[model samples]
Target: MAVKDRDRFSTTTRIRLLGEQTAARVYRSQTRRQARRSRLTSRAALLALVLCTLIVALAYPIRQYVSQRAEMADMVRQKERARQRVEQLRDLKARWQDDAYAEQQIRKRLHYVMPGETGYVVIDPDAARQSRADQGAADRPWYSNVWDGVDKSDASDQ
Candidate 1:
């Protein structure tokens, strides 16, 4: 009976030890997994921080680069316009250098004719009448017109 009691006690003690070992193994594995998860979370957080910082730091320079490119495009357009204007002026200058063009301009603007040429003056009667009606102090002598303007300014002041 004493031997049987000893075997029973030893068997019970071994079972208890086995249960405790299993519980300890499960706790250790859980802690290790939690540690791995924390490390991963920290790494992800750092990566996100780095990305945010990069975006903030690059934002202003990127914006400035885009704006400068737009400004450069505008400047190029203005330069093209100026070049066209220069080309037009050069063509006009070249035209004016020709004696025939100069003569034509003089004839058209100043109503000039060569000595042997008979020039006919065409008049619009209505336009002539309107001009005559519109003529006032300006048609008078310069001295009289000046005095008339002075008189008008004086009257307005009064």
Candidate 2:
């Protein structure tokens, strides 16, 4: 009877100790999980920092690269335009080299005619009248016009 009482007491004590140990293990595991979560937050912060740093470091260079590419394209367009201008000038030079074209340009610009050809000028009467009205006394002979200008200036001075 004393042995049975001793066995029962020991078994109850063992069960109580086991339960305490299991609770301690669960508490330790929860603490470890919280520590791991904190560590993950720090690591995430570091990753975000690195990403922001990369963006700051690379932004100016990326912008410059894009702008330089645009400038290069503009230079290419200017080169093409210069090439077209050169071609146009060469064509104009070729046209000017011809005697017939030169003569036509002279006749059109200077109103000249070939020798022994009668060239008639068609004048607009309204334009002629306007010009005559605007001529005043200066359309006369040079001496008369000068005398008239001198007389006018003398009269103004008096």
Candidate 3:
């Protein structure tokens, strides 16, 4: 029994036992470090996923907000254009209210000559190919247009 106890307490046996225990402790510490690293990695991946989801969820509303703002700006511009057009129409209406302006437009557009006033039109060779007789309906006569309309209707029937 003393011999067996001496063998157990021998330097070689003690060194072997200490080495085994140290090896086991080192292995356990490495395993725990790996577990902690894995947990950190998983947490980081979860955080990244959450951030991506939030960005994706907000993307459409953000895009819509920008586009709606642009649409509103376009509408404002259209409204301003419409307002300007209305003002121009109002000014034109005021101009037409004046008897002189109305008379001038009628005379210019219809080529009218009041009573005995002579009206002459210079024919331009480079201008439109209007017929000499149809240069101005007023130049000929009102009855001429009526006759032309009747003639055209009669020709179409044939």
Candidate 4:
């Protein structure tokens, strides 16, 4: 036999080694890409979750703000009505403080007979019947009804 070349490897062994190295590299690269993709997907999901939480948390406060604004508007309207009523009452008070106006109101309401002047009351039959039936608020004192009428008329002056 010829002398053996111990340093020389077989061609099949070199080819097999190269194929195994390539397979390992491919597997590692695929694993790295999958890991990166999964990481990105997780981050996106977390961002979405945070956004949903923020929306949910602010919903009640937003509703409360809208309702409070409506209530504030109603209160402002009520205040305006009250202010107008106050101004009307002030004007009526000034008018009633006059002697002639007070005497005229008393004469009209009470059907009082002045000196040498005749006073006659013309009552509606239906109203008289209703008053007799207690349907009218005549159980109260006449002055109370008059004062209430004065107050109501003052309010309507606005």
Candidate 5:
């Protein structure tokens, strides 16, 4: 009757129904947001994997290309050095072809003298002292140093 009608049309009953509908809508929206977040995460992971794969695939070839460029530069430097050396040798050969240069080299190296000329050598005092000091080791052959090393090793083992 009238009481039942009053209960159905009460303000509190209407407020309760509206609140429930709002809560349901909020829940649905939260689930949709979560799904979207998961999809975006998967896409980001796939992109990262693709980038890593590309870096790995190109790594070795890029390294080899850089190393080859450096090697080519080194070879070019060696070629230039060799060309300079050949030029120097050619100039030396030309100098030696002259008779005066040949005589000068013979006089300097072999201490040779012409028939009526005096051949006196002036020695530096400082250089003579250095030679005297080095006579203990520098004047000796390399084999002597090696044999001394062997003797020291034998003495140490004893």
Candidate 6:
């Protein structure tokens, strides 16, 4: 009977020890899971921080590049306008070189009359006095006054 009692007591002690070991394993597993969760959260936060930093670093240069491109496009448009203006001026210069156009401009500006055409001059006394004064300043040839009169009329017309 004593032997049976002793065996029963040993069995009870073994079962209690096994239960304690199982509880300890459960606690260790829970702590390991909590540690893994915290580690993953920290890694996610670090990834977000790196992404934000990259965005901040690149933003200003990208904006500047876009603005510069727009300015370059505007300059190109101005160059095209200048080129067109040059072409128009070239055409005007060509027209001025034509003999008939040149003669027409001269006749209109100088009020010239052809041979056998009557030419009239309406002189203001004050201007005539000034011209006579200017003529007295030099001992010029007689034809100089006639040429000067023609040039004066052309300049006044313009």
Writing each residue's lDDT as its tens digit, candidate 5 over 69-128 gives 999999999999999999999999999999999999888766688999997767667666
**In lDDT terms, how accurate is model 3?**
0.88
RMSD of each: 7.5, 8.1, 5.6, 10.9, 8.8, 11.6
- Report the alpha-carbon TM-score of model 2 versus the true structure: 0.61
* Per-residue lDDT of model 1, residues 35-74, tens digit only: 9999999999999999999999999999999999999999
Alpha-carbon runs more than 4 Å astray in model 6? 1-36, 105-158
lDDT preference between candidates 2 and 4, better one: 2
TM-score of 1: 0.56
User: Any idea what lDDT model 1 has?
Assistant: 0.85
Q: All candidates' lDDT scores?
A: 0.85, 0.85, 0.88, 0.82, 0.86, 0.82
* Clash number for each model: 0, 0, 0, 0, 0, 0
> Which candidate's TM-score is highest?
5
- Residue-level lDDT of model 4, residues 55-76, one tens digit each, is 9999999999999999999999
Q: Considering TM-score, where higher is better, how would the candidates rank from best to worst?
A: 5, 3, 2, 1, 4, 6
What's the lDDT for candidate 2? Answer: 0.85
Off by over 4 Å in 3: 1-36, 128-150
Clashing pairs in 3: none
Residue 80 CA displacement from its true place in model 3, Å: 0.9
Once fitted onto the true fold, the runs of candidate 2 whose alpha carbons sit more than 4 angstroms away are 1-29, 124-158
Greater TM-score among 3 and 6 belongs to 3
Provide the lDDT at 44 for model 4: 93
